[model samples]
Target: MSPYTRPSIAPQVFVDADGQVIDYGHRWSDSPPTEAYSVTVHPERYAPLHAVAAALIDHLRLTYDVEVDEGAHVVADLLVAPSWDVPRAVRVRPRDPKCAALTFVFTAFPGVIVHAGLLHDFPYPLCGCDACDTTWQREADELEEHVFAVVSGNYSESVERRDGEPAAWYQVRFANGSSGGSSSISTVAPERLEAAAVTLPDLPSGWRPWPLRHAAEA
Candidate 1:
């Protein structure tokens, strides 16, 4: 979004008596301005640095269709902290009260947005019912099994009953080279294992499952 026409504020820079740079930083306003938002640009690297800052604001406006007030300002600042790993922070104020104002802080890397904190307060419906939890758990289990099979190169599976009970338990055997045969077994239960078997896909190499320990075993 186009920023409001406000007076530009120069970032403070500190240097030693020998002309060595000590600190280069900008301080954010303690209170929100009378307008919507503000922009700060670093004095030493204003041109290219402010371009990056302006592009980020434009992205939020175009992508999210957000409105910018005519009186707000944009500040481009220097990386004063020892760590340059800070993410760009954007604060949005929507005119509608029902729509909550949001602050999005995210690291902008090539082809990825890392450590994003966008939807922490976004209004999204969430279900914690047993049925919903069970369904989600089953899907996750199936995904884990598929990854395990691909990594271990073992697709052999079977369902069997113990002590004349229903055949609701299933086991997958993996080939262990040290044993000179397939003997490593992974077990799953509760009848949903059959459904996973039916939907199993032929996996390729280089896929691995996260080491997961069952709570019952714990």
Candidate 2:
């Protein structure tokens, strides 16, 4: 069958900043394929980072040809007021009435796009309030520590390819937010990245399940 003839379906996978698979999504190949199954992702569900939402949307579109709605996934800047006290300072989501889940979610890294393993490492920190920070100090520390794993300059220098062409690379963004940029690590050639690890850091995280029909908005 052609690559795009039937929608790509596979086990959902999750990974850490080190690119280690944490949990693989359940799969049922024996089950018959059907279009009736549906899952909804409320924009108001889990507040996510702006950049993360962008990356997720981009990945969905480029990887699966999905479309995100404005109502369900709000694009404008979202403010998590200091006085109000929420985890994130800002959030973004689809503003659409509802977000439908796909029949299956890809949990592994996309062979095409550059996966930001930094989600587990250099993630944008979220703190609801000063009191919460003091109360949940331990939890915050544990979470922040995970992000640190992918921040070093060693991993950022690596590069990867897409569809037989050089596509994306990695780099460390400094705390100062003034220095650093992406670098090429694809010296091994495209075929290598498609089959095995290009960077020495660790294996890239696997993809997870997402809405199949709504994929066009991505």
Candidate 3:
């Protein structure tokens, strides 16, 4: 939890000085958490985000047939692209991987990408300074905001992917008449992105896809 040390888990996921999403790994090394982590020092040791994720999953099970991996509920990056590593990508195996589920990105904004076609490009600076620490809290708030946005349907979001060059011009638009995106020059290029959309029957099961949805909503 020290600003100088890597938190095994923060309130939510965020990228590190390196461009990888912080997860329950060996902490100092690049290795993922071993099986012992789930029992002894699980990453959700940061209880706030864990509780939030758990609550959403509990809510979903009330109406749907939800199945989760034995220890699927862990603190990890919501896999978008290899380069779009802004953490807060929490996941619980509610469905088959990337078949018909959406992705939730709580980095630049609370974006619930309905499909992989919508690329999310954000800043992944190599700096690990106090200034970035301050920025971290502000950006990390997106997770809570995303939950609120999805549950209440009160979010204004836009997805923009980098284009043209590494950090140069980025072309932005939407399937409908969408707007709002980042124009910062300090961004890593987006690699491939692919995720599943939660398959929802058209019976209006009291729930449907929103422009931005949490992983639980899937």
Candidate 4:
């Protein structure tokens, strides 16, 4: 939790005529293998990131017999000031301390190294507009939503995954007994959503588990 008061203003999005975005800043990870969920966010996003960390733990508790790390703040903003030193990153831990960490790097990319197998680097392009933000947010939203779905097998009435196959992927059997699967799953993806969340790999790029094709409100 971020107890420190923060500035009302946030880092503004700037895209030059060439379609390149301004380099706000960069963060370097010692590349530590901390068995936790960590997100490298801009200073402005500290609060929301903190909330998400707690929510993940809560979600896990519902479906699985879970044990979270002993801590007051599961999601912590490294810093959240308004001046020279602001939040460079946020961290979330929702499982056993012995498990591998899942690191999300949502920041500038220069001089950053993400060699750790568990870490994911989301570098903001040098030239981008508001669209980039929307895309990134959408990606984050999809990740969280699908992760929970796959973990709880809640995307459909019942689910079964065939991950041991050459092209690893999961299949969803809807309440109507109709099932669908990924068109192409390059390499081997995680068999369980819990593994997927921790590794956060590039596979299973299009799970398409949203907008409710099974049933829509409208």
Candidate 5:
């Protein structure tokens, strides 16, 4: 039997602007892939979150033929410390066209860390404030409430690797309208998340967690 229980912060149903958790994320897969993710935002920033997520998903598929899994919740940020050594939290934002999205930013990390300051736009003609600050506080609060709950239950799983290399990874398969073999996935990356950017060849339809293609194989 698997030696783990449900994550306390297990990606719960996405709470909308009205604080209602929607039953959209999560699905059944024949292969039972590993890893799951979601996109969330404060009750007020729902429209912005969805808008940016759509752009990001389209950018991924166009740049790479791979499909993103939509089973994970869509939140405003993935609240994590800027680094293991730092206590200050960082927010990861989705892409948006109406606002000047910060594709990436250099941080105080050892090297040039690409801060997914996706919502770090400033003087928004509409919001009249910096996007990053507004979303950061709300998203960070949400993440703080859930990260420990989820990580406490995060565990490794055995899966068939591309070859017989015995790689450690997980998948969040999609039984929904996804066009790929899997749903959302989280694995080691060749580059850091913020620093990694895929140039799109064509316009995209919506946003979903982009797959980690080069994750270590099992």
Candidate 6:
């Protein structure tokens, strides 16, 4: 499936200097004057984009406590030009009069090139604002509430085994009784179903594995 086909969701992103994403439901604004340094990955090197993006994000989080949006488009601020060359580095100067200019650099070895001094500071603190805190809490609360909802039966589920596979697939019915959503749940042994069930979300949620799908399953 194409990466852009999914429903609208918050990007797995860390806002530049604000320490918080723009907003959960809003789009990242590129209104302010900004500069972006991007590298066009040769088609042969395309497979590494995921790892490159991930490494960049990890570097930001580990070194600067900055988080990029999870959505591929949003993470690289490529919404308008979704197919724009993958951004290896991005710098934003928010239109807000109070914000400061910030830069981000992403690099991976063996093929990905590292821009010198691309990251303004090797280690920096995430933005600490009431808005940031509230955004963080909102995401956390939504997740916790959804998990409880699923475990409490606000959502119902059906299990079916694929014809050729040993795994069972799960179809979840939301609290509102909506259908059309499903996932593979074959990896959770029967013994651990209960424990796994408690972690699944029943609400409209993000990309996180709800109902506890094992990583190995992916």
Compose the digit string of candidate 6's lDDT tens values, residues 80-154.
122224445554332321222233333332122211111112211122232223233343333333323333334
* Model 3, residue pairs in steric clash: 13-88, 78-89, 98-196, 100-197, 100-198, 101-196, 101-197, 101-198, 102-197
| Count of clashes in candidate 2 | 40
- Model 1: per-residue Cα lDDT over 1-218, one tens digit each: 23322234354444545877533221223443443133222213222223333444454444342344321121111111112233344554333322223332222220101111111111010121222221222322333332234223332223334555433221333443211111111323324345434423222221123122233433
Q: In model 6, which runs have C-alpha deviations exceeding 4 angstroms?
A: 1-24, 29-138, 171-173, 179-186, 189-218
Quote the positional error of residue 13 for candidate 1 in Å: 10
Estimate the TM-score for candidate 6.
0.24
lDDT value for model 5: 0.26
Q: Lowest summed-lDDT stretch of 10 residues in model 3? A: 194-203
* Candidate 4 residue spans exceeding 4 A from truth: 1-12, 17-55, 58-64, 69-134, 155-165, 172-218
lDDT of 2 by residue, 1-218 (tens): 11222122233444545887532122233442353133211211112223333333444444442343433122112211122222222121212212211111111110011123321112222322221221122332322232222222222323445556553344434344522344333333345354334332343332222324344333
Q: Which residue window of length 10 is worst by lDDT in model 4?
A: 110-119
Cα error of candidate 3 at position 47, Å: 5.1
Residue range 1-218, candidate 4, lDDT tens digits: 21212223333565545877634322113332343124233334323433343354444434343333432232121111112222233332334332223222233221111111122222222122222222333333434543444343333211224555333233433444533444233322344334555443433332222121112211
Where does model 2 exceed 4 Å of error? Answer: 1-48, 71-127, 134-208, 211-218
The root-mean-square deviation over C-alpha atoms between each candidate and the true structure, in angstroms, is: 23.4, 21.1, 14.5, 14.8, 19.7, 19.9
Per-model TM values vs. the true structure:
0.20, 0.20, 0.30, 0.30, 0.19, 0.24
TM-score of 5: 0.19
**TM-score for predicted model 1 compared with the true structure:** 0.20
Scored against the true structure, residue 97 in model 1 reaches a CA lDDT of 25
